[model samples]
Target: KKVELVTQGEATELDKSLVEKITDPLTHLVRNSCDHGIEMPADRIAKGKPETGTITLVASHQGGSIVIEVRDDGRGLNREKLIKKAREKGIDAPDTMTDAEVWNLIFAPG
Candidate 1:
């Protein structure tokens, strides 16, 4: 599978220190998008999507803060898989948990 990166709002400027502070975290987000968010070529084709996945990074100023967003064109988190993993890790993953809660389990420590 192939991944394409598209960046937007390149004109948005920030202080050098702020950029340095954010660089690592932003890189991590992009890497996660490529690694976890994108699907393989066969999987994408089976799902009726193009063979190549796209990850978009956008930076903009909103109110008093700068916002950076990473978006990907791929299958999103699998709820059942996440819940199963959480339970396997001994986390309390009840059937009543909301979709958002299940998704957030990805951030939980194993």
Candidate 2:
């Protein structure tokens, strides 16, 4: 399968220490995009998307901090799976909550 990587603000440089600190986490995020965030080739074709899924990394300086975002044009985080996992783990989330709230459950402590 083909995966397209789009990088924004590539010219923005950060402190070496900060770059080192974020490297592993950033790599993991990219891996997740390839492994889970993007659906299979067959699925993408069925959905009328190009066979190649795009993973976009955008960076911008906001105030004193640099904001780096890793995003993908793919299936995205599965809402239903997240909600089900929350329920199974006994996380206190209700269906009436907004989709964003449900999505945030992925970050909650067990």
Candidate 3:
């Protein structure tokens, strides 16, 4: 039910620093998720979901750190494609790693 012009990060009483650090990165991440991460209407329909898939961005305080999660029910990360692409770039990834770890590896410096 919240609405605003800028659509930037929100802040709780203890979130001043967190709000600053996450605002720009969060904006870019949301833009990327909407533009590239989520599938198109036809793709969603083919995958057995509704035409418009929902993207949820949540922020909360978890102990000493703030936790933010950007999630969508659309297609998750494609592990095989990522591994193949990484291997093409000569990055060695251990097979014992999980998809979540592999996803972070995509953000690592090459």
lDDT of 3 by residue, 1-110 (tens): 11112222356344478669878987877666776667888887888877776667766667877677776665777787778778788888777779887887768666
Candidate 2 matches the true fold with a TM-score of 0.89
Output the lDDT of residue 39, model 3. Answer: 80
Model 3 poorest ten-residue lDDT run: 1-10
lDDT of 1 by residue, 1-110 (tens): 69999999999988899999989988998888888889999999999999999999998999999998989998898999999999999999999999999989989996
Model 2 lDDT, full chain set: 0.88
Could you tell me the lDDT of residue 35 within candidate 1? 83
Per-residue CA lDDT of candidate 2, range 15-34, in tens?
Answer: 99999999998998899889
RMSD of each: 1.7, 1.5, 4.8
What candidate 1 gets wrong by more than 4 Å, as runs, is none
Give the runs in model 3 whose Cα sits over 4 Å from its true position: 1-11, 94-97
Question: Each candidate's lDDT (Cα)?
Answer: 0.92, 0.88, 0.68
TM-score of 3: 0.72
